[model samples]
Target: MRYGMAIDTKKCVGCSDCVVACQTENNVPHGYSRDWIAETVEGTYPDLAMEIRSERCNHCDNTPCVRTCPTGASHVTEGGIVKVTHEECIGCGACIESCPYDARYFHPDGYVDKCTFCDHRVKNGQDPACVSVCPTHCMYFGDLDDPNSEVSKKVATRKTKVLAPEAGTKPQIFYLI
Candidate 1:
């Protein structure tokens, strides 16, 4: 279904609530995160504008991690979610190196780990944990292929950007700025 996300920068407050929620919901290891907050400040003092965004694996249509993995552990599901099968991962670090977003990390359990777009929760008819617990309601997740989906609508109507677009990953996540 080409699942994706749209995050409104105007509504985000850099609270990292999404990060915490994702970690809790995914059972992420201590000191490791499935999501993180990125802040960018422009100008100085009175003329300054700061942007705070929640960042994670983009679940790219041309996912480099998947292409680089030797064991097929990193693969894209039918619904367009890029997921890593921990049991099949050998922690060769090739996937981590291939990702331009620096999203995947070697886990303590000797496997690679990164955001899965919460495909488990999504399959159960629930929003991704990061999107659900956002205090400002800044995050929206749904099918990018469905024009009526909130995420698709926001992307169509708002000024949005994807990180490292030049890398040609064709990331599914859109940041509305």
Candidate 2:
């Protein structure tokens, strides 16, 4: 099962609710965040187009983070969730350097940390904190391998894009435009 997330950019309001939820639920340090809202504005003046998205680890199928980890701390878990084993991490920052999405951060406790898609919560049949608390309900998460899953259906039906696709990471996060 390839777990993934589909975020509707048209529905997102740049409220940062998902960011706050991720921090509170993950117990992230005050200065750090596992996810954040990114906004892009293009064109000129009144003709400008704006896209706001909640961004985090892409959980790539061809993860450069996992490939660059000298200590094997960065690894892909079940359902394509990329995670760092804090105990095994040597704080080398290799994974952080390799991530095209700039998702990994060095923790205060001297290890790397990033989004997990709230694997603990997912295992309990609950959504990720970010997805659960999105006020606009723009986020959808489920097994992408299952054609009937919400995420899969959304990806199949909507116009979507993945960040840094040229990097060839095969990122699982989809931005529905």
Candidate 3:
């Protein structure tokens, strides 16, 4: 099944709670983050509209990072989650350059790092760290292939947008605006 996430922009409050939770759950290093809040302000003065989005790896189906990895360190799993095998990574930086979202980062340990969609928790039948800790309950994660899943239902009913659709990555994450 294809796993994915649906985030409601209207419900997000620009709080960085998801960011902190992700770092804590994944043991992300200092001066780095697996996810972050992106603030976009439109218009001017009293007419200004602000959109706060929690952003992370899109986990694209046609992942450029995976394709650029020489050692097969970056690969897609059976469930369609993109993962990097640190042991096999050569730290060549090819994957970093190819990523459209600039999501992957060079780790101090000599490897590329990015979001794993909390595979550890998902394998244990739990939601991803960010989703579990979000106070607004704006995030939904599940198999997109399953019509019964909340993520799938949201995509079907809501006016959602995927980041950089022209990039041709076919990102799994959908934003409900």
* Candidate 3 lDDT over residue span 27-96, tens digit each: 9999999899999999989999988899999999999988888999999987899999999998999998
lDDT of 2 by residue, 1-177 (tens): 999999999999999999999999999999999999999999999999999999999999999999999989888999999999999999998898999999999999999999999999999999999999999999999999899999999999999999989999999999999
> In model 1, which runs have C-alpha deviations exceeding 4 angstroms?
none
The true-versus-predicted C-alpha distance at residue 49 of model 1, in Å, is 1.6
Give the Cα-based TM-score of candidate 1 against the true structure.
0.97
Locate the minimum summed-lDDT window of 10 residues in model 1: 77-86
After superposing candidate 2 on the true structure, give the runs of residues whose Cα lies further than 4 Å from its correct spot: none
Better of 2 and 3 by TM-score: 2
Instruction: State in Å the error of residue 122, model 3.
Output: 0.3
Per TM-score, the best of the predicted structures is: 2
**Global lDDT of each model?**
0.92, 0.96, 0.93
**TM-score between candidate 2 and the true structure:** 0.99
* Distance from true location, Cα of 77 in model 1, Å: 0.2
1-177 in candidate 1: lDDT tens per residue? 889999999999999999999889988999999899999999978999999999999999998889989999999997789988989998999999999989988889899999988888888999999999998999999999999999999999999999999999999999999
Residues forming the 10-long window of minimal summed lDDT in candidate 2? 92-101
Off by over 4 Å in 3: none
Superior candidate under lDDT, 1 versus 2: 2
